[model samples]
Target: MAMRKAKVQEQVVQAVARSNPGDRLVATVHGISGPAPQLTMAFGFIMLFVVKYYFVTVTERAVVVHRAAKFTGRPGDVVFNLPREQAHGIASEVRHGRQWNSFRLLFPGAAKPTRINVAAPWANDLGRLLSALGAAAPASG
Candidate 1:
């Protein structure tokens, strides 16, 4: 299991590093991409067919996300990319009276952090991401 994790981690690092040559990688994770702008929350069920996975790559200079239709593959079109300077900690809140394994990207000066977000459900490495962004996540709903 350790070997597999290392191998997959290496692949994710490589993919991010290839596109962002100058930035140093911090952490990377796979997650379910957030809903599209045109689609309302009422239609979230349709995302299952439109997207299968999203790869979020965090580097010293930025936090980037790439959408993917397959589980094991390179990053596709760029979905979300926030530079470190404008980035803030990830917010993980309890919703529906439960701990949803999801998170939202925060911006230091943005009035509404969740206004334009690239939320993801596979956000288990919350600590790593928060540390990289240098902010605390509010646990409130």
Candidate 2:
């Protein structure tokens, strides 16, 4: 009986995974390198750095939730949902962000997964982007 129950649970999880694949989560870092000609060259390096460290795509049975934090300058949490089998691998990367950390989990009782931390300079723009994404996610979800 226990084995039978386990098989059923496994099947259910597989069904969920087949329906919702993982998504990619990317956190772009932006800051001034210097000024002009010199800054332009430096900016290239900065972009490369950001691309290498922060280009994450949550693939295979996952959902991304962008959370907005009440802080300044730090990026908000971009949470990803993973199949139960893949959940363990996600924890480490989720906690190792330069500006923000993330975690993988099942749906919380009421909260969403992805979040963005807005800075004073970017508050207005970030707020709008988040709102738009939030509004759009429901239909996609």
lDDT of 1: 0.56
The CA lDDT at 119 in model 1 is: 37
| lDDT tens digits by residue: candidate 1, 1-119 | 01244565677677677677877878776554445433634565565565446666779888887665454555577666788776655444422213334455443455754322223
lDDT of each: 0.56, 0.29
- Least lDDT summed over 10 consecutive residues: which range in candidate 1? 92-101
The runs of at least 3 residues in candidate 1 whose Cα sits more than 4 Å from the true structure, single-residue gaps closed, are 1-3, 34-47, 50-52, 89-100, 106-124, 135-141
Cα RMSD of all models vs. native, in order, equals 6.4, 17.4
Residue 25, candidate 2: alpha-carbon lDDT: 25
Candidate 2: 10-residue stretch with minimal lDDT: 132-141
Report how far residue 51 has shifted in candidate 1, in Å: 4.4
User: lDDT tens string, model 2, 68-127?
Assistant: 221222223443343434433222112222332222223345354322222233233222
Poorly placed runs, candidate 2 (over 4 Å) = 1-41, 45-81, 93-141
TM-score list, all predictions: 0.58, 0.19
